[model samples]
Target: MKNIKVKTLGAVLAVLAIANSHANETAEEQGEGMLFRSLFGDTLERTYGITVSGLLDIGFSRNNRSTSDERDDGLSNLPITGLSDEGLELGSLHLFVDKPLKANAIPRVTPLPGPKPETADFGFTIEALYGRNAQFSRTYGWDMGWDMNEEDNAKAKRDRLSFMSVPNLAATAYLPYGPGFTIMAGVFGPIIGYEIPPNIRLAPNPFASRTYAFVSNLTTVSGVLVGTRIMDGPHGLLGIELGIAQGWSNMRDNNDDKALLGALRWRTPDMNTWIDYEFMVGNQENESTRDIQAPTSRLISADGQLRQQHSLNGWHRFSEHWLLGMELVYGHQDGDGKPTTVDIVTGPGFDGAHWWGANAVVTYQIRPDLSFSVRGEHFSDPDGFTLFPTTTARGDFNAITAGFRYDLNHNVSIRPELRYDWFDAIEHDRPFGNGRDRTQLTATVQALVYF
Candidate 1:
């Protein structure tokens, strides 16, 4: 807790320093800064030039189940469970720095006669982030049929207050094609998480002689991203970005991942409606098997396991005060070829499934700086992907959320939101006991200040 407070104070100080630097710049310098300011908006203008920005997101909610169940298991088949009663979760605190190729250097005004133009725009950026959340569990209590004693429960509760920090660093190069088009390429180092590595082996016998053990394994990732934007005419605009990364740990053999995304904005003379689509694909090697008899059992291979998602959203403005929007999302995961494990066991073929959902939202502008919105979403699993061994039937879930946002100033905004979620069943037979359904009420107060 003390460490978090200190980090929060550092972030606040960074913001103030950036503001002071911009205030002291001369008019000519400000005019040159306007180009970047207009391109990245207010948020990027303040932080992109400096090297640090901080964010704090604290939320509270009430749930019928324990908080531990809310953790995302990375398995789409797992039945979603557990929620918090009331607590604070830090969303992110980001510190980034940009390094330009030329420092305080002036470009030549006149080009060589009959010579092709030569210009170079290259830079690099490094970023660090901190995020926190509460973990909870449901099986340790007497109500869940567990025979655990009081001491075990207390130990588990103590473990739930842990936090995680992630640091990311990347380098970028900008290539200009003309007045309004440029291609950007970047490579980022691993996003190191301050927790136990995801995949590791724990031997059963302590004194057993080890013939083959891979000890130098570490959790790391590397990725490349490219983005392009065109501002040709006044009628519309187009933008696209793609990224690919490879995992450096032993979770899978020959493991490499990929992601692709694109967006387009179009507006008529009146500028009333717009549409967007986003997609992502990731592949990871599944659980591995080793033979005890063969010293050469550590063979490298690809498991052909992957997860894919796609989302499309559209919005239309009827007037200055009202807007309507709809969104569709689909996701699928193909478990490894090995027969899925019940408790650290593996066997053959695809063992998982897919799910999809649709949602709609309505927004009303109550004032120039305030807006109210309501949203509804429904989700279901198809092909009956199983997470827990007790059941094979996947149920449906739905949620409704309403919220309002108040802009305190141009760079800061506050949002208060309320949400209700319902699940069809805990499993197939455990449908929330009686007709009374599984429900959760969540309230969140978020403050956002950019740059």
Candidate 2:
């Protein structure tokens, strides 16, 4: 009887082992998803909100002129200014805090009924940046004409390398008043150019270089902007925006005159194409302001001046691996014996000073981790106003850049680029460096790490 009992138990054990084997086989047939889930969380359902982000960028460049002084001081863009002509440089250290508004719903039917309807939402963002790039991020709109000491302190801080600029210290609200309106107020970039300076988290390429057009156009403003979607469907989305604020690049009102800003944004259905039209018009400088200092240069005026700018930009993706972007811009400023920011020259008055430019960029993704890009641009600043070469007038400038981005991983990338610059001379002169050449060449390598 004891032996019989032992045999039955053995049979039961064998049956259970076989069933376990079948279950393992079934799991394998399901593409090892069960094992994957056991190790990593679901990609689609991973939740994220209220995030903190940062970027660290470093680069080295060799300019053809080989002069560390880099004579083209005011002509180059921020961070890439005169200080970065040679050797290794810290590009930018940017940090961002984003708290986007969450969607909430209200009960459609009150007494034990159906779905809930969402109401208007609100959110805010703050950006803190350091390094050479901080110079361009200054905002003057917060100057309330209250305390002179405080204003001086703020100005001093802005000049330092550890500059604190709340570039995006703004509030946003989504009001269902009309066809879904969005109102934003604070300091924001002027929506007039295609080459947007990248914050820490949004750098699209490995190399952190910019076109000449971006360096010359409008940069930032402080004020209120209202926008609404005109059309949104499978075909695409169209939007129009209007804004009023302090004149270009001023945190404080240089004058009582206000600037007007407008934009039209459109995106294709598949989200591969975009077109933008933007403009700004108003008095830019107030020389009569009592607290402000007198104009020290021809580009800055003590007298109030009027300026208007317009830009049209378009971007299209031909495939998963190829893309193209283009921009056209025209701007005019009434120079009142003072040089405008766009053109800082010392000479006769600039009553009808005008500037225009065009830019195009092409990108090809060689692989998921490697990509290449080329950018071409041309800008014209007539009257020897903006593109004033050293002791000469070089009204027209052209540049071309080629670069490649290689991603080390999700958090790190390396970029190498080469650039060539040429000029159309109204007067024979060298504008790029202390060297006596109408053209310049440069090479750079950069690394970006994100957290």
Give the number of the best model, judged by TM-score: 2
Q: On residues 139-230, what C-alpha lDDT tens digit does candidate 1 reach at each position? A: 11111122322233334333333333232345555444442222223333221111112111111111101000101111223455554443
- Structure candidate 1, residue pairs in collision: 68-136, 338-348, 339-347, 339-348
Q: What is candidate 2's CA lDDT for residue 216? A: 54
lDDT of each: 0.40, 0.59
For each candidate, how many residue pairs have backbone atoms clashing (under 3 Å)? 4, 7
RMSD of candidate 2 to true structure, Å: 15.6
TM-score of each: 0.58, 0.75
Cα lDDT of candidate 1 equals: 0.40
**Measured by TM-score, how close is model 1 to the native structure?**
0.58
- Residue 413, model 2: lDDT of 70
Alpha-carbon RMSD, each predicted model: 14.1, 15.6
